[model samples]
Target chain A: MDGITVLIISNNIVLEKDIEMSADSKEKQLIKKAKMGDENSFESLILGCQGRAYNIALQYLKNEDDALDALQESFIKIFRSLKTFNGDSKFDTWVYRIVVNTCNDMLRKNNSRKNTDSIYWNDGEKEAVLEIPDSSNAPEDLYDKKEKRDHILSCLEKLNPEQKEIIILRDIHGFTYEEISEILNCSIGTVKSRINRSRLRLRETLLEQS
Target chain B: MKCDKTREMLSLYIDKMLDDNLKKEIEEHISTCNLCKKEYDDIMEIVTHLNEVEMVSVPKSFEHRLKNALQHERSKISDSKIIAISDKKKNKLRMLTSIAAIFAVGLISVGLYQDIIGGVTDQLDGTAQLAQDQVMQERVMNNETESDLYNSKLYKSNLDEAIDEKQKFEIKLDVADDVQSSDALKPRMSIYGYTDDNSEPGSTKALVPENYVDNPSVDGDSDGYSKDYSTMMTSEEFSRALTIQAIERNVAAVQFYKGLIEDNLRDFNYEILESDFVQAGECRFRIYIFNSKEGYVFNEEIIAIGKDGEIEFIYTNEFMGL
Candidate 1:
């Protein structure tokens, strides 16, 4: 989950140029049917968002099982309460809000259990014996690159959950301020303020680590 | 803008949420103000790192699990609709109808409006739909409550006969006599119903579900068996069948639902209650009671057995008063 997020988020640089609203006419039609208790329609409506939902949960939980658990929980809830979506807001935002809530629920539950804090490097076992020979740089340079990547991730998990979500949503996911506000259920002003504050916190953490 | 004002506006300007004029003004201020400029550089670096954060691919199994869960919820909803047809109790039917109506009201405008709105769907158009409905109806009918339905008798079982006339289905009437669940808006008046405590979780004994019996293997096992629950029927092990699946399915469905609608109820333990078989027309079902096993609130979960004997959560309503 750690390295995977970097791969996907780095490639999603199209956010600046992509301005299409959440659901297309076809999706909107499906959404309508889904709201009418059509399971097939509901499945179609959620098909696209599932990947993003998984990504968000992965970023939040940093554990694969927890991420999937959050997603399963969120989708079930979404299906149950599809009736609550009144088209007042974008469907994507509604889905994002529920994903956030589900992640929060998982976090709260896991925190309550308080059994152990296990740091899992996803697929670490398979990658541990890797031999990467880059054409552009020496192995030492690549090692430094890997180190820096890990360092950034290490700093990320240090922030509190609110700061973590704000950074991920705004900077990594490149969601618009308005969209983030809707997702977080905050005002545009709050989104801006919080993003800045989160950025400030991350900066401090990186500086301290350095 | 003053330095303090400029500091706050910097974020908005960078995010493009601010006007051009203000952005220019802030840009000018940062040009003259080295301290502010350094602060902005630090913030920009943080944003760069944030953007580098990777996107993880969902594991192959995630889709598998999600589809399974959706199928599970679909079955539950379909089960609920069947309950509407099978349960002649006016109060219970009213509750189910309102639940359906509430969902419709919450949705933005939708089509197929007539089928699921106002009343139970009596004549669903498709064969698949009718087949499924008929299957559910048959299950409910097998519960052996046919005579009671004809006599206009309540859902009073021998559990009721053994206790007393006043104590039929005593759990709701007795244990539910408390403040309504915090989620319910209206304060509910308690009507004492059935209450029999079966708090010991059988998760210890039925380590594997009763229906999940071993299938004879092709000489793979010394016991010549491998665990398979593909075909589970209620009539085989009626009591064991309903309680286990009901507990598992209800918990999973509720957790899924609680996540979707943003409920803040903390995770609580589930206590299995006694189950009874009841029938109406073509549908036969086992009604199971699963209250909050311990601590926090007076919520009661009632689930039912489907035609194939799979379990589905009906509703979790609170009884108030006292």
Candidate 2:
């Protein structure tokens, strides 16, 4: 497997470059090679997808350490199950599914251990920290936007596990309904219904908060 | 088109799931119907707000940590394999030494026994009888101990089995467990029971298990119950109950697959060998079509329970055209 070593210049620069080449054909090619037992190709694929995978794990698990553990476990699973990838869904969607499963497993384990203190951030904490895009609004509107974003996260927390997953994938990750359906191993009709219901619940949650 | 029908399709329209023709119909209806248009606008606003929500980035060290962990796992696996190989070699050597020592001991014992023959055999027989009695007593005691141990194990296992069975029964009845509240629980329909009851209504009471008596209303026909009891469940309630069962079955299928994979305990990955697509089973689902009275539009939640008792959900936009 052909591997590319990306030199970390700076955070902002790396983030920009990652966004630019995020959907490059080379990444898929690397993933294909990695799936065929090429460690180097697998390494490159990991390097490319690691950020997003970690972000997803973080979103689900909340704790930095748990997120890290999930990320590693997810990568190992990806390596083991790479041969099962049929390219029916986007590589990212497949990767995200693995991450989500890993996170869920971790959540179950943590629940069994009664470890509630590790990742219990409410929607307010997430909103206060994360930045939201507001193209039409001025600097004065930034505070209100943040509050709304926080409200949304709080609403997200109230959703059922399945609803949360679908909403996050569709609204946050920007996955298409078809891609989500394939990743979730459900019919397209089921996927749409879940998204629709989840959105309604989210709206209800926000309205209730107001 | 009726305002209610137009309102039901508003979500699909926002989702872009509606066909072009249906979309045009909804658009036309919205133009004339203020209530429908207002509902549509509200849903769109919510969708837009959700879309604008930002995602948090993963920590910078996340990738590095994953790569390091993978490397560590690989090393550990390789090390264990090497250790196992070396251990096998050591065991073979130890076995050879033990065999040589056993042969040496047997040869020396035989020589000693041959030298002390004659009257010693008679005395040995007398002593052996007494020793045999002692051994028999010991054996009986050992057997008793073993039986006691086995019985204790059986007792504990039986207790566990009882608990599990009771828990499963409660879950089936929508009863609350120790871990969670069950106040808002809904009853689930059973496909096999439904078929059996539908075939013979009077016999439904006999077919139902004793545990199901607590939640007898799960039976769609209510088993020829009074009209008051029948009115307790709305049409939507009937559909929802059915959909829940369907979701349970669906989830059970997946759980069965997971169980098979876990049972093998092999590291081998699954491949799509072959698939036979068929739908032979009866619709074993409780379909909950909410907001049905207002219009034909309904949100259906199907619960499918598989043979293994695992539950899965399948929500559908059955009334998208309404």
Candidate 3:
């Protein structure tokens, strides 16, 4: 049993290393082929990141139909714009930014603009700028995790588009702040501040709802 | 640090984004600060809840529809690029023809065009035409008797076919690549055919010639020339005029011209035949017919280096008795 466990673990590490290197080299080859007007390589390249991109769009556009529509629109854009992809950064980061930008554009055009009210407090004034209705449940009373999980998605909807994207990228996608910064085309400092504000706002929303 | 300031950085502390010293400072401040601690706990709960939120599942119908749309989109893109390349090629040919027309106009202005029209028919009187295969064969491996075997009607059809199949200009059959210094490339004769950059679909690109420049970069004005190829002037004057316009002015050698030629002109060996002024139509040409076969066999080509250094016309023919 011990020998088998060690073999499996060692195999996993090697496999993981292969996956990382393979994914990178594969992407480079795919980008080159796709740029030269190879639709097969282009299809494979887009499909590689298709799942995450669709999920990101889903997080932004809530409706299942809209999410798929947004994803299709982004792919069309990426198809047309493949030649302009100079390969300055990871293909995934570039794709993420495109998907995110497309989602934002859709949001703007739909004008289903969520009120991005950021709360602030002063020592003299006894209020959060954006008020949260009081809740009886304490912050620690989140043990019924599944129910709270549903509330979080609803709360995510309430946060502004920027805040929601940062939260989704960080908490759900579990991307590092640096990765988030690169994908968002912003500094790590901006990513940090945005996530902090977003988390606080989301926490306030969750507390009031519960 | 103040409670508010520490609270601002509380999330970074959780994310391990804060430097250790700053993190320690925040931890210590929050240790004494209950309100900041409570705020920190609340934010932590939010993050925890979010992490548990299941990844939005992609609907099956959506996935199917997207793939279908993508297939259509992919084909559309490929078709457009293929179209773009072909369109660019057609444009390139038109551009070359325009340059040739301008060169012809220049010849006309100098009274050379009238002389060319008068003398061309008389120059090749008995040899009215030859079949394309017979012509190609005569220039290469075939004997002269093949021309007498074919009728005039067959020759005319063959001529139509040759024109329809993008008429060949200069055909260089180089046996080996011999690299020479870029500076060695002066007034050497060769042809350039503008082509699609994707030589072999997804092959590597040749190192961009730092020294290999084109018309705009070399001499600034490509169309600026003293005179056309065939002139009333002496042969030496004609060569001198070409040498001055193409060589002295530092004209750029053409890059890949699609199906015509590949690789730099500097890589090939060239022999300068005793060139003389000749005319086919209204166009005047410096007929370069060399009997010496350095590598294999060479043919009768009307060579004219444009003022832009572009080998505008490099068509070959097997004149019966050149």
In DockQ terms, which candidate is top? Answer: 3
Q: Tell me the tens digit of each residue's lDDT in model 2 across B196-308.
A: 31353323221224434355334433233323334343335545755665555444444343343222213322232222212542223333434322111224443332222
Give one digit per residue, the lDDT tens place, for model 3 in B81-131: 687667657746765665576566556544653464345333223233444
Off by over 4 Å in 3: A1-19, A112-143, A208-210, B82-86, B112-322
Question: Per-residue lDDT tens digits of candidate 2, residues A1-210?
Answer: 123223444666878887778756676677667755577888877676677677667667657888888887888877656654545456777787778877887887886675533322224324332233322232333347566665566556655557777877787776788878766778888987787767766666555545
Model 2 alpha-carbon miss at residue A134, Å: 25
Q: Report how far off residue B198 is in candidate 1 (Å).
A: 95
Ranking by TM-score: 3, 1, 2
Sorted by DockQ, highest first, which candidate order results?
A: 3, 1, 2
Can you tell me which runs of candidate 2 are displaced by over 4 Å? A1-29, A111-143, B2-8, B80-265, B269-322
Top-TM-score structure, candidate number: 3
Tell me how far the alpha carbon of residue A163 in candidate 3 is from the true structure, in angstroms, after superposition. Answer: 1.8
lDDT preference between candidates 1 and 3, better one? 3
TM-score, one value per model: 0.48, 0.46, 0.54
DockQ of each candidate relative to the true complex: 0.18, 0.11, 0.27
Clash pairs of candidate 3? B193-B257, B194-B257, B194-B258, B195-B258
Measured against the true chain A, the candidates' chain A TM-scores are 0.74, 0.70, 0.77
